[model samples]
Target: MCGGDFMSKNPEEAMDFLSYVADVSRGWDEPTKGEVGKMKSQLNAYNAKAGM
Candidate 1:
């Protein structure tokens, strides 16, 4: 939730934040799969917001 406001206000920042989440999640273990799924949902939200 660190950049919730920034992401909502700035599409570019949202994309960057989501990309970072995706990159970081790539190094996570299986136990963190659920967290990664959450990130995916966030990414989808960002995409929808930015009309990507």
Candidate 2:
């Protein structure tokens, strides 16, 4: 439940680039609005790979 856990990289996981973006135009909620949620999801998906 820490940022470090979310930012950890897995050796077995495929590396992926996460592009940071903001969606604040009202109905952009993919569980939560704004870039915060999206970023978190992306990070989790990518195992928090850097150079994002």
Clashes found in each candidate (C-alpha, N, C closer than 3 A)? 0, 0
Q: Per-residue error at 37 for model 1, in Å?
A: 27
Task: Summarize candidate 2's per-residue lDDT along 1-52 as a digit string, tens digits.
Answer: 2235535756333133122223243445544465778888888878756544
Decoy 2 TM-score against native = 0.27
Off by over 4 Å in 2: 1-33, 48-52
lDDT of 1 by residue, 1-52 (tens): 4444763557877788788888888877554778889999999999999999
Model 1, residue 14: C-alpha shift (Å): 0.2
Clashing pairs in 2: none
User: In candidate 1, residue 22 scores what lDDT?
Assistant: 89
Which one wins on TM-score? 1
**How many Å off is the CA of 24 in candidate 2?**
14
lDDT of each: 0.79, 0.50
